[model samples]
Target: MLHLQHDRDFYAWANDSAAHLRAGRWAEVDVDQVAEELEDMGKQQKHALAGHLKILMLHLLKWRYQPALRGVSWRLSIDNARDEIAELLEDSPSLATKLPEIAARRYPAARSRASLETGLALETFPVECPFTREQLVDQDFLPDESASGQA
Candidate 1:
C-alpha cells in the first residue's frame, strides 16, 4: 500500500514516510523508496553544482575570448553562478571535494556552449579548462581580456 502511494503520489509518500520515521513506526516506512529518494536528492544537488559551473565557465570563456562583447549581463551571470555554487558547497561541504572533477568534466560542454553562443570556432577555446577550481568560484576572478584566444 505504501509502495502504491509512492508510485501514485510521491508527495504523500514522502510526508507519510517522514511521519512514520518520526513516530517510530519503522515497519510502516518504505525504507528502500526513502533511500532511493535521498540518493536522488544528492544527485540533484551535484547536477545543480555541475550546471552552475557550466554557466560560470561558459560566461568566463565568452568574457575572455570575446572581450569586445563583455557587458553587465555577462558579469551578473558569472556572479550569480558563483553565488549558487558557494551556496551549494556550504550546504554540502563534502561536495567541495568533488568540485575539481565536476569542473573538468563539465568544461568541454561549457566551452562548446560558449563557442556556439559566441559564434566562435570550437577550437577558439582551449582543449583544457583554463581556470583553476579556486578561480572558478572566486567573485573577482575574471580572466584577462588580453589572454583572448591564446587559451
Candidate 2:
C-alpha cells in the first residue's frame, strides 16, 4: 500500500541519504539504493559521452561528404561537442578508456543521421567510424573536402 521514500520521492530519498551519510548513520543509509544510484550515474556519463560523440561524428560526416554545406554553424557544433566531451572526460577520467568502444557503438546512428540530414545515401558513408580519438577531440581537426582536414 505505501511506497518507500526512494520509490515515492527520489529527491527526498537522495537528500535523506546524504544526511544519513553525513551524520554517519550507517544503519539509516540505503546501501543497495546508493549503489544502484552510483551505477546509474556511471551509465548516464557513458550515455552523455556517446551522445557528444554522435553529434561530432554526424557533423564531421556532413563536413566531409558535403563540403559546400560546411560553414560556421557546423564548426561551432563540432567544437561545442568536443568541449563538452572533454569536460566529461576531465570529470571522469576513467571514461577516457571507454572512448573507442563508445564511438564504435554510436557510429551507425551518427551515420544514419548524417544521411537523413544531408539527403546523402547511407552507403556514401563508411560502415565503420573513420575518425580516431585524437582527431575527434582536436579543435582544428576538421576533415577536408579533399582529405581529412587539419589545422
Candidate 3:
C-alpha cells in the first residue's frame, strides 16, 4: 500500500498510479496526488487559452497600429491564433463562459507585449481594451482607428 513519493519521481509515481488504477487496487492508488494532477491539467488548459488570447490581441494591436507595415505574416499569425482559440473552446465548451473574463484579465499583458515588441510607447495603446468581446474573437475583426479613434 506504500505510494511512490510524488516529489521524488513524478514519472514513476504516475506510472505506478496508472498500474494500480488498472488493477483496481483502490486503496493503493495515490488519490490525493491523482486529484492534484487532474486539477493541474485544467489549470494548464486555462493558462494555454490565456496565452493564445494574449498573442491574438497583441497581433491585432500591431496590425491596427501599424497598418502601413502590416504584412501577410501578421494576418497569418492572427489567423493561427484564432484557429487555436477556436480549437480550445471547441474542446472545452465550459470555457465559453470564461472567454470574456479571461480576455479581460489577459489583455493588459497583451498590450504591454505589443508595445515592447513594436517599440511604441505604452501610452500609444489604450489603458482600457478598445476591442469588444465580439471583436476580440471575430476572425474578421480588426480595429479601425479611422472609425472613431486615433491610430
TM-score of each: 0.95, 0.93, 0.84
Backbone clashes for every candidate come to 0, 2, 0
For 30-63, candidate 3 gives per-residue lDDT tens digits of 7987998999988887888898998998998898
The digit string of per-residue lDDT tens for model 2 on 8-39 reads 99988889899989999988888988999999
What's the lDDT for all of these models?
Answer: 0.92, 0.91, 0.84
Task: Name the best candidate (by lDDT).
Answer: 1
- In candidate 2, list every pair of residues with a backbone clash: 143-149, 144-149
Model 3: residues with Cα > 4 Å off, grouped in runs: 1-5, 8-12, 148-151
Models, CA RMSD each: 1.8, 2.5, 2.8
Q: Model 1: per-residue lDDT, tens digit, 1-151? A: 9999999999989999999999999999989889999999999999999999999999999999888999999999999999999999999999999999999999999999998999989998988898888888788999996774322
